[model samples]
Target: MPKRTATMLGCAVLLGMLMGESRAQTDDPSGSPGAGRATVWIEPSVSVGATLSSNGNASSSNGRSELMLDVTPALRAVLNTARVKGFVDYSLRAEYFLDGNSGNRLSNRLNASATVEAWDQRAFVDVSGSISDQSVSAFGPQNLTGLADVNRSETSSFRVSPYIRGTLGGLVDYQVRYALQTLNTDTSIRSDSTSQVLSARLGSRPVGQQLGWFFDASAQENDYVIGRDTRSDIARAGVIVSVSPQLNVTLSAGVETNDTITLQRESYNITGLGFDWRPSLQTSLSVSVEKRYFGTGYNASLEHRTGRTIWRYSASRSASDSPTQAGSVRLGTNYEIVDALFAQSIPDPILRAQAVLQFLANFNIPADAQNFQDFLSSSATLNQTQRLSVALNGIRGVITFNVSRGTTSRLDSLTTLGDDFDSNTEIDQQSWGVSYGHRLTPLTSFNAAYIDQKSSGSSGISSKRQSVSLGLSTRLAPRTSGSVQLQFGRFNNTAGSYNDAAISGRITHRF
Candidate 1:
């Protein structure tokens, strides 16, 4: 670590400890009495580890063995109160190349979310930001997007949304929202963008066995710093019909207009139908379909909780400047969500253990995006993405399998999946992977995964890849743990084929 970084980090540790100690002696239940009105809590930890790599640079003929040392420190803070609840997770990683095939490298990642309440609680603000690096290949060690090529770049994004939602009276409810999103990159390999969205809705919420009507209007503008810009507007009116306690139907009609050529700057009519169904307390499903001048688009999501297994599924077709969220994608907090859900479903120890097993074994790469490998382009596109995933947990162990497929085209290529891909074109890709894990003993466990990915680029070339990994983890101490891992992969394309393998071990101590 740099001298300045070390000095600043030391100060942070001291401050956090002092604050924590002082607050513990304070009289207030919310915080330390003498700490005044500080609502933010911080926890930081440091970790150092060493690894032996068979191929550190992930090359073919030039593979070399070496010993690597790495230092990683992280900080996490949480805020929970009547008005706000959120957290920030940040980490700094520094790696040293002892064999010197590669130079020393250091990188950091930060993810944070903050929500604020205002206007006497009628209005609220949501803020999120991230800075991270990603490999060009969507499935690389750093590229979980699973949709790109073989390169690495740093991407950062920030978003701020503020909205007011409240009922005007028992007869009507209203909401107004505005959002600003900015994307930045440290390198010139990608472009920057700023997006603004403004929307409003006036509706009569469905209650009991009643009919409700709603009016909606929204506008969005996207500016690509190095490319063309887009402007879009939408207006709609809809009605909800409640057929029963477990079912509701919505019908809507609208007009859409945009100045972005990708979506055809033309004006189009929008017709849509959406439904929410809850047949039982254990299952829920929602689906929406719409017809527009550009094409047909749909979004659907289903979730079910059962005694032996948990399930989640979602599919969507829409327009997006980028397929992933916040320019980088990671699997959402699915495991944690499942844990929380099953926590309420039953108290059976077996089921609880199964849930825990599933969480530990099936932890996945964030699939918020299509796992796309495409370079970040400034152009917008109307594309389709489908994802299906399931996990089973039991005494046998935990196993998870899922596949994400995407068909992308430029705004102008919406008519068909393209045969040629370029910095400005379209492609089709299917990526899938599976992971399994089971505890071998009380304090040790083993896990393994296999992934097969295929993609058809605009260049009319196809590439396929397969990767496999196995690892074992165990607790080393009260605040320390260790793991050993082995990974192997094969890649074949028009260029040639290559195989690479690596094995490494690391121990992390938290303080």
Candidate 2:
């Protein structure tokens, strides 16, 4: 299918299903807002700024200095109804260089997701989409600023999932789900692809029993616009036991067949063990281990919250084939981190989210700056990743810290041109960041932050980038604000090294 036609078809299907479901439900008789009726929020804002950069092109050596003007108009919309929940944040940024040394540019950024209960307790649908700037190559030049660069490209992806659930005469509970996803990029270095997954599960429906069992099956296929298609199928059966009020254990055996490693399909036995532990309301731990066709795979995570702090840690190793899944790994933003930290104190999810957003905005913190991102690839890979994060809130200040490391190894021998795995067998990436914000006055705030990232390929290519910044923000008036920032950065790699310095001021008005 053509790209544009596929996009339109996906949108039409999502809209038709959502509209059909909306007509089937009636308004709540209680007359209370958000109970059954739709509650919507729309926020629009614009910002203008001028920046002076010592290195505008982000070149490795002998870069030219330039002065640029930037204007960004952004909108955030949130919808809440008895049957649907969704939100979208979008921005359009325009840049013009005053020195005539570089051409003008325009870019778009968006993030959105929605879930609809189409058939009340039996059927549902999920839709999500995103457009963002990302690096095309892991070995290319790296930068701290969100400026236009030759190595960066606009990437977008969409997913639609619809599923049904019910029970069979008080004997077993079952669910069947189908998901379709598409990925595209502005640059030719990365391949656009579509993925389809169909999965089903049947489990014993127990009222108060301590033991249960389940059967699972799934088939997945991925087709690339540039390379050969890949497919996989798996079937499994598992038994679950409640060890105690706070712990549960599961054991499973299965078989999987796939053509990811070679042209011919191969079969392998699968064995797995897993446990979930939630000793208290403030903590949770989950661990799973499995022996698969590629190798031994495992996942573990721990989360704990205190009155004024939160800590999270996770580690995992698995085989990944779809670029959409690989690129979706995220460490979240400052707002999300702080929101999770306040869950113990605030209890209410909606209230906590609003409070966190307000607090970050007041302190001039960048709420959308993620700690790490992965480059896109078409070939299959064995990926191992680890992440740790913590947030602390005090009476007059807030601090957050995050760190992550990951390694990707080629799983297939086929040489896909322009793929990261084409020349190197393995790639390693690591990043860490820390930020502090303090209330200087009732209406003014101060913030400081530092971030560092490093990447290395087994083929003897490596790059490192570091940045430090300070800023101050104050409320100019109602629905208006102004801020100023100063930043310095350093970049080094096998090619060369460069240093950058920048200062900028901006004003924003909300409506």
Candidate 3:
């Protein structure tokens, strides 16, 4: 059979199932005493679209067209009072592209949970399971090229977990959870492999007047059927103390350990302290400092809001023993300009802007003291960069518009990475769009939008793109609705020019 015929058959099946479910629910009573209980309801939808593209260059032009179909089905359920009350959900999705250049794909997912209540709703037990599958075809266009190549690949995963939580004597709360995850990978050039991961977490909180404390610890073990093994463990604790009605302080610290089956193991220790203060109803500030064996950093921010205007400022810095240091600062503000004009009938038009600057130093480090000293003495200068962005938005009734622009400048000494990675380069980009919607009747509406974008990079590369879309939605019956959409786009670049068009539609029924 033809691809189009198969797609139509799939759509018919999906629609039939949805209609059957809706009809079944009509005679079912709502969950109540002495009610004939129905345990589940499933909803599904399918859509088909066609895409056509054409390209023209100074020498030649090429064109192609493709028809694509997508099917998505969802499951949802509610259970009655059986010492547990929860829902199970599952989805199956598949897509087919008519053009032989692209291949078909299918994906499946499942999630379910169960819960039990104890001690008058103060304690509970929860169990959950999740599974996923993904597969790709071999006949599609190749993505990567190497000496040893794979024709096709598939991956599947599953996870199971159980946990318990409750408050103790109305003063303290505690919780614990454990999870096991397994993965299977299949490839054409290599033998199939499997892996497993086991993880556990335990935590508790102690309540007090004006002061609270909490602690948590976790561990994970990873084992591969045909690879090296790894393990990780972490422990953390923190405290929150209220100094006044408007002031609070927080302190936290943690340690992490990593072990490898055949390599040197490493450990890291980290600590941090922070606080927040509110001097008035419209002003607030926060600051924090942190240190670790690998690096050190600090951050702070201040914000104020009054009437229809708001302002903010922030800064941060970090240093590493590996001979690298970096810092950044930013200032931003937003104002409601139109709200002050029409307080009753119209909403506000808001404008926002921000400016940021940063500096970085790069140097090499080694275990040998002599090598590290020599590396620093070579004289490396710090690089500086700056960026700025501004945007404005407005809304009135069924129409909305937004516009934004951004620019970046960097120093020339930072051009060692690539032509596109030069520090002395300047990049400018801008985008603007508008959307409108109108309701012709209580159950019907029309919507449209037009968007345009342009961007340029340091390598003198520039491009422009624009798109226009229109859609209509309507209710065909009391329990059924449908929508149709049309879109067109054009793109122009230094290398070539391209144009594309597409049309799609969907219909759904609900109980």
Candidate 4:
């Protein structure tokens, strides 16, 4: 598909069906004639599948036996109004081979977001976008299915922000923001970027003050279509010490300037400390530390809850220049860490994102596979991450587990021609996964999963992957559904070792 991407996806589906039928025939200035207070939700689906492979073209030498054909169309939507909020999920797939020796494909997936409240509660606007099928070489060739096309690629991202916040008579607290971000790929194998940021803040008023104060400033720029252009700035000030009533603390200092690793412009000195603790109501903790100029940075998190479980932990280190968030350079999943552990039991963000997509569709889970795997970088990097996850949710069963580790390096040494930190100065990764479903009744359901990944580079290059899946899903009427699956995968590197096995089936219909 490319006749200008199918005419720009048919003019964005006819401009989103004429702006959703002109916003459902607009009207509703607080109601009356055609009283509308817009609300729209739509679900559309279509799927057809077939797959039988031993190595359908992800060939690692004389591997053949292909039978693939799959078609998919999907959409999920939500929009609510009074001042708008929106969400969308989209999909598209087409694959066909039937032994024509592999090749005939198209893929797409998207996640979208929107928010607008133009002047209510102090002006706002935010937008988001995503598309995926990454890995343009983090040591190339790795797969776990999307039906083969190994060494992946198809990345997209977008973001927009506009902001203003108020409170100056409630004794100081203010905000100002601006953001723009972008990333794209259709293959140039990485390098396409744009980022801009402007920020402001002034604070005080930590619930009837106990010694509070704040000041913050920001500036950032990253522009690359082929590298070179990075700038950063920061300013700070702080104090907020309520050391009790469940704790609070902070202290900060300022100054920063950058060029992201030389070619002039370097200035530093910034210090920080942060804290917050919640002692109960199911536990919480937060932490922060900073002493920048690439040396010491930190952010920490912990959350706990039980009565059917949810536990999470996090750790971080900064400076990852844009790919529009998500552990920068795209990372974060297990369905956004169990939808942020169901935010204190679904505190409505559209019903906690539809109860985390019906709890990952009753655990046939693979909302982008238990996290961490993103590659394609163009300068500006420095990260260190850690994760731990757990989820339970029972009755008819659900379980999940996760583990993670990360490291990356290169904060630009002035465009070291063509990515991967110009021959790995650093790169290390690790991942883990486990899943189970079980609800063999109420219209079937039983699933299983296992995952693993490993990577290393410091110019010694390395790679590894493993996957296993089992599935069964039912409900064959009332807008139909069906599924069947068996899969296996393995990959290794130092340049060799590959394995695969598969069986698949699908049927879906909905409107």
User: Could you give candidate 1's per-residue lDDT for residues 170-288 as a string of tens digits?
Assistant: 77889999876776665564556777788999998667646888999988887765556678899999999888889899999999988665544779899999999999977999999
Q: Per-residue lDDT of 301-409 in model 4, one digit per residue for the tens?
A: 8988877788888999997865553413222366676776677777656567667766666555656564567687876788899988888878888788888899988
Global lDDT scores for all candidate models: 0.64, 0.81, 0.43, 0.75
Residue 250, model 2: Cα distance from true site in angstroms: 1.0
In TM-score terms, candidate 3 sits at 0.49
Using TM-score, give the best candidate's number.
Answer: 2
Best by lDDT: 2
Q: For candidate 4, list the clashing residue pairs, or say none.
A: none
Candidate 2: segments with Cα more than 4 A from true spot: 2-38, 326-331, 345-349
- Candidate 4, residue 371: CA error in Å? 25
Error of 3 at 237 (Å): 1.9
Ranking by lDDT: 2, 4, 1, 3
lDDT of 2 by residue, 331-350 (tens): 14786788787777776444
188 Cα displacement, candidate 2 (Å): 0.4
What lDDT tens digits, residue by residue, belong to model 3 across residues 1-511? 1322332243234333333444454324555677653433333433333332221111125544555566666553333233444434455767666554345667555444445453465454443333332212111111111001122344433333345666666666777665444444453322122222233333345333577776777675554343334565667677778788678888889886754312445787868898989999668898877774324556677766544333445545432111111111001111111222222232211110000000000000000111000001001122111212122222211443445454433222322422222322545556666555556566776767676666566666766667787877777776566677676777566666656666666664544
Candidate 3 off by > 4 Å: 1-62, 70-72, 76-101, 104-158, 167-172, 181-208, 222-230, 243-248, 259-263, 274-438, 448-468, 489-498
RMSD of 1: 6.9
